[model samples]
Target: MYDFNFHKPATLDAALETFESSDDGQFMAGGQTMIPVMKQRLAMPSDVIDLGAIDDLNGISAGNGLVSIGAMTPHAAVAASGTVQDAIPALAELAGRIGDPHVRNRGTIGGSIANSDPAADYPAAVLGLKAIVRTNRREVAADDFFTDLFETALDEGELIIAVDFPIADAAAYEKFENPASRFALVGVMVCRTGSDVRVAVTGAGPCAFRVTEMEQALAANFNPEALKGISIGADDLNSDIHASAEYRAHLVGVMAGRAVGRMA
Candidate 1:
């Protein structure tokens, strides 16, 4: 890593102040992606503001038919939380399956959402579940939160406070993971709340996106067979060494089918 000033602010206000004071300052959440980028000299921030000491950014609560997860809450905590498991077992399962034990223990939900990795699992869940992202300044719906690959609606010096996920009638997440990184090659989240059916797919495109056709089919008939003839176009999908765009598109259908099957 290049030389930089590191500041561990004990309060959120202090962190925000430090972040705003410098144009080249960046927030350090779990240091998962940011650290790697720094080591590769991809980012050379003048100041690194560590949010680890901010006590207000860690907690999990369930009430009013909604589950609120703090930005700083670790994936392991989210996976193991009684409230999360009781309210949304599939979400908990998804969290549990993220990366390895160490990654789960260190990576934060806010970090994941902010990074907005094209193949990240949480984006699918957020979009499918219709969760609201709470930031220091405002609340952004899941649809508006993600902009594009490695990008979000978050502005400079703005920090995510928490995420509010409303409980759904039935939901599940299924992903075809890369063996090495455990990142999804194609992940799908299916949610049925009342009469509304939402289908979100990740790892198959530039960003997590809703499958309107699949959602319409599921709304009519919530069954794995509903996705039998449906196929995703491969033109916009990520094509890497591990998998081709066509393969990822194929997995989108397969994973969506599995998710619907699991829900059923």
Candidate 2:
């Protein structure tokens, strides 16, 4: 890694101030992706602001028909939280299954969302649950939060405080993961919130996005059979060495079916 100033601020204000003052400063959350990129010299920032010391950025709380998860909260905490499990077992399960034990222990929800990896698991849950991302400046809806591959609505010096997930009537996530990395090749999260059905897909496109057509079909008939005739074109999907765009599209449909099946 290149020579850079490292600051571990005890407060959010201090962190933000340090970040704002530095040129090309980066926040270090879990260090899962950021550290690797730094090592490869893919990203070289003048300073690194660590959020680990901030006490407010950790924990899971659920009440008032919603679950609020701290931004810096580890995936393991979300996976193991009794409150999260009780209120949204599917989400808890998804967290448990992300990456592996090591990654889950080190990765933070905020980092995952902020990085906005197309194949990351959290985006599916965030979009499906219609969560609200609370930042140091303002709250951004999940729908408006993710912009594109490795992009988010978070402005410079804006730190995510937490994510608020509204409790849904029923929800489930199914993913086709790459064996070695456990990253989703194509993941689908299905949520039935009251009269509305939401289907969010990740790993198959440039970013996590809601499938309006699938949601409309599910709204009319909340059954796996309802999606049988629906076809997801491969043009908009991602194609990589592991799988073709068409294969990813196929996995999207299969995962969607499994997700809906789990809701039964």
Candidate 3:
């Protein structure tokens, strides 16, 4: 890894102040993506500010028709929380299915979403549930937060505080994951609340996005059969050695169907 100064601030204000003072600073949350990149000399920030010591950025609460997860809370905490399990079983299930035990214990939801990896699981859930991402400065709707591959709407030095997910009437997620990495080759999240339906897809595109046709069809008839002829074109999707864009496009429908079926 490149030589860099490290700071573990106990409070958000201190963290922000440190970042502002550095010539080039990067926040480290769980260090899942950041550390690996640094080791490869892919990233060389002047300073690394760790968010782990901030007490305010850790916790999970469920109530008032919402599941509020603190930014620094690990994946294992979300997967094991009785509150998450009861309030949104699909969400808990999704968290449980993330990369193995070590990654789960070390990876933070804030880092996952903030990194905005196209194949990451949390972005699908966030977009599917239409959750609100709360940063130190402002609240961003999930629809507007993810911009593109490994990118987000966050401003420079902005810190995500928490994510608030509304409890949907019904929800489910299905993913065709790469066996080795457990990263989604193709993943879909289906959520229905009242008369609204949302179908979000990950892994196939530059970023997690909604399938308007599937959403419209499901809103009219929430069933697998309703998605009969629905399919997204492969022109805009990712094509890697793991899976072709055409295959990912096909899996999008299959996964969406399976997710909707699971919600039944």
Report per-prediction Cα RMSD to one decimal.
0.8, 0.8, 0.7
Q: Give per-residue CA lDDT, model 3, range 1-264, as digits (tens).
A: 558999999999999999999999999999999999899888899999999999899999988899999999999999999999999898999999999999999999999999999999999999999999999999999999999999999999999999999999999999999999899998899999999999998899999999999999998998899999997899999999998999999999999999989886
What TM-score goes with each of the models? Answer: 0.98, 0.98, 0.99
Better of 2 and 3 by lDDT: 3
Give all candidates' CA lDDT scores.
0.93, 0.94, 0.95
Estimate the lDDT of model 3. 0.95
For candidate 3, give the lDDT of residue 218. 91
Candidate 3 Cα deviation (angstroms), residue 173:
0.4
- Tens-digit lDDT track for model 1 on 1-264? 668999999999999899888769999999999999999999999999999998899999999999999999999999999999999998999999899999999999999999999989999999999999999999999999889999999998889999999999999999999888789989999999987999999898888999999999999999999999998899988998889999998998999999999888
Score residue 188 of candidate 2 by CA lDDT: 97
On the 0 to 100 scale, the lDDT of residue 47 in model 2 is 97
Q: Model 2, 129-218: lDDT tens per residue? A: 999999999999999999999999999878999999999989999999999999999999999987799999999999999889999999
Q: Assess candidate 1 and give its TM-score to the true structure.
A: 0.98
1 or 3, which is superior by lDDT? 3
Error of 1 at 27 (Å): 0.6
- The residue-level lDDT of candidate 1 at 136 comes to 92
**Per the 3 Å backbone cut-off, how many clashing residue pairs does candidate 3 have?**
0
Residue pairs with backbone overlap in model 3: none
Candidate 2 residue 192 Cα shift, in angstroms, is: 0.5
